[model samples]
Target: MSQLIAPHGGHLVDLLVPEAERDALKHEAAGLPGWDLSPRQLCDLELLMTGAFSPLQGFLGRADYESVCRDLRLADGQLWPMPITLDVSSEFADKVAGAPRIALRDPEGVTLAVLEIADRWQPDREAEAQAVFGTTDRLHAGVSWLLDKAGPVYLGGRIRGLTLPPHYDFRHLRLTPREVRAQFDKRGWRRVVAFQTRNPMHRAHLELTFRAAQIAEANLLIHPSVGMTKPGDIDHYTRVRCYEKLIAHYPEQTSMLSLLHLAMRMGGPREALWHAIIRKNHGCSHFIVGRDHAGPGNGADGQPFYGPYEAQELVALHQQELGIQMVPFQEMLYVQERAQYAPADEIRPGETVLNISGTELRRRLHEGLDIPEWFTYPEVVSELRRTHPARHKQGFTVFFTGLSGAGKSTLANALMVRLLELGTRPVTLLDGDVVRKHLSSELGFSREHRNLNVQRIGFVASEITKNGGIAICAPIAPYAEARRQVREMIAQYGLFVETHIATPLEVCEERDRKGLYALARAGKLKEFTGISDPYETPESPELRIDTSEMNPDEAVQRIVLKLESLGLIRPRD
Candidate 1:
């Protein structure tokens, strides 16, 4: 295991930051809206400061030195790929394995450090090569020595694990009018519209987007987010493929495609402005704004952070300022008979309508129910089916609802291993403890905070399920209403199975892993669930296996059966 360095002296293999530049780095990051780097991130920043990864350095140096400055217009330079970040745990593994290089730095024609591409790492040779880097007199002793001795020490900072937004060359950002106009001239279309969504393409959404294009008398650019979108949202690979399928429906030689690898800040109004700014950068004259653009979560009483029109209105407010036009519409509700998208303003009263949400659409697809072309095109459905074959590939919310000491996490890990072997579909397990550690780091264990805590996990799990993946959640999810809210969110994805591991309070109290239950009984703890807070187990869950009565294996077996019976898990593919 790669050791986590505490606050102390630096080790080798470390990215060293001069004290002079540390404040400057933090200041630059702080200048960005809604950005905060953690302590470990500060250490990582040294890599950028030390010239290990100067994403914009090359663009700034040679390009500017050799050529006279162009009128800082759109022709300033060509576009380049956005900066990239590798997940910490994933990168740690790659470093230990000595993964093959996907890209490398060259200084004065001399090779420097190389990096492995996150998605494509052929582990065999690298894994063998990594042996010399570990401890003892092993071949990897040099690497081990560097890691132990040269790594930077944590000096008490924030977000020690989070990655940073990339610093890219501004010169290589915008799409020149010359290029875009050239394409427009080829296609015989003057005006162009862009459709941007961090979602899988649904019929209602397509109707809205395509209608915007048609209304603008322009071709469509189905641009999707391929970066750090909402956590638990469909991964870009599936969403991108889904877009490819739907784009096939557009008239040939008219529409185009692109991907935006931008991370979401979860800032509502500011997010709209940012989206408009980016769309402008991509040579889009106009953008489609939906209600609550990029809303991260709800507010005080389960209401969304902003009203539906608030995001759109924010764009409308800044439309001229940002140099982009906005097409804002109410949330599109599907009309079956018309079988296409229509403005909510145009729909007549008394039309028999099914208010199918992205959630319901996901539910139907996950349960193996056939979807009509009216709701979603055959091509898109085919793509979804490829990932989640209706009946055979059901996503799951493996909820572990028990007291703290009831061994929920242990069983969860074992279940994860078993499901990994069955690996026909992706699985994400959200343990309460783990979620608390990673996501709700700022919150404490207050009752209100507990709700917020589970809400975040539910949101993530819901995203996973929406994108055709399994979610295994194990929280007390104590309040029935809170649990219901989570269910409603995951319901958007269709495969929401709540497995309540009902162990008796006495059993849980006796096995208090944290001794909190014991303290609660001894009057040392207050507001503890099952003692003061009361946990209402699912009265009507899909599966209610009593772990106190049945063994873990038997409980898991029963849970699997419930899955099979519900058409979530099926005969071997």
Candidate 2:
């Protein structure tokens, strides 16, 4: 008697082996070639096994991969908007070549599944990126990961799950597709409308979702992605706590909260269609499709990649085939006169509307400014504040990059002493020579080695910033691209201040305290920066100091002023 939509491809495709067969599968997998799945791959496999990614029994083989990329459909004409492929290094591909099966394990060495190999091939990644994401530009996060981080080869086959990946936290709230459908059945909820979100909900979200469900005459499913989202998104732990608090405000028996482990691609319009199919698999009769659903904010050009209404339009185009009704997200605003949320289009002509954008909300949290009760719940704000303290109270990094002997070390040492004098936080100095002596004793001046050294420094600084400490790093990070990589790595947790010690190269050579520039000029040093090798200057740094014209104290004072202006540190009394 339920009117819920059927799973994609007509059945819930659960590949998890029955209890009777798991023991044998595990035993057989021990002898097969093994691959430790990455975090994103593990999330994909979990959904495939649990029927959350229904119709995808395994990673796509060559034929299916090509088909999905060229068009958002399987070879058999089933609509699937995304391609799920398991990529591996060339060494693994050669080892698994012509093998009947391979074992997949987690980082802890626990065998989770076995893949019955069907096909192995190297994909034209550029083509895939263009067709699937509409661009091959590295500025897009997904495209960047695809080009730089992913492996060279892909393996595709059917998967036999021996055990589901273990999640110790929020175990009760993590429901499989079957379990959620069963819950709906138990509640006699024949009509269920699912709302997908990756961010914390405010009053506007509650109003929009409630109105959506009310219009559809269905129960509400508050499903949130707990896996990897945008790089700087709120951590799942904090977002989940916020969800737990917000759900209390909903009417009992009308709404349910469930967590999903989905590594989102931020694919914009295509992602909207994929999400609709997923909700259909979860036994929902309706799904909410909003403006900019699943969109990665902007491209490198600082323009929106997809039109604001594109996602809604794309879902509407395919909802009939997808079998899930689309409930468009209503733009709700708090009417000041009535003090209640009303659809933007339906408000009276003279009525005032109040809204809080995500940027404003973050600004309020960062500056420790008051967030109005009309915008967000007090409990939710408290949970956010616990994770994101005020900007001045939070930890940050000060990175100094310039040519060798450009007074970077002196300025960094002076700044470290000044921070230590404040006696507010732990301060650590990572000078180039000191770090080379300790951390990079084995690394040489090759481009690859230099990149590795900078990455190691970025990782250490990120940890320090994450734990509420100050890290002052001074290095001749010559390549602009490498410096950008470090900036991206550290920006996820805290502010990354790139201070360019813009002393002229001639002045740096004239100082030559270590006499390295002399050796380079005499052709004694190979691949020496600014001599034999190229040094790409930063296009725009947070602070640029001309150490040739100013002493170390003045340079440090300039940096301190920059940090204070950005609210990273308090002004000295």
Relative to the true structure, how large is the alpha-carbon lDDT of every model?
Answer: 0.57, 0.88
Off by over 4 Å in 2: 1-10
lDDT by residue (489-533, candidate 2, tens digit) is 888788999999889999999999889999999999999988999
Q: After superposition on all CA atoms, what RMSD does each candidate show versus the true structure?
A: 17.1, 2.8
318-394, model 1: which lDDT tens digit per residue?
55555557877666766767665677777878865656666666677667776876677787878776765575554
- Using all chains and alpha carbons, the TM-scores for the candidates as numbered come to 0.50, 0.94
Candidate 2: lDDT of 331? 75
Deviation from truth (RMSD, Å), model 1:
17.1
Whole-model lDDT, model 2: 0.88
Clashes of each: 16, 0
Residue 232: error of model 2 in Å?
1.5
Q: Best TM-score goes to which candidate?
A: 2
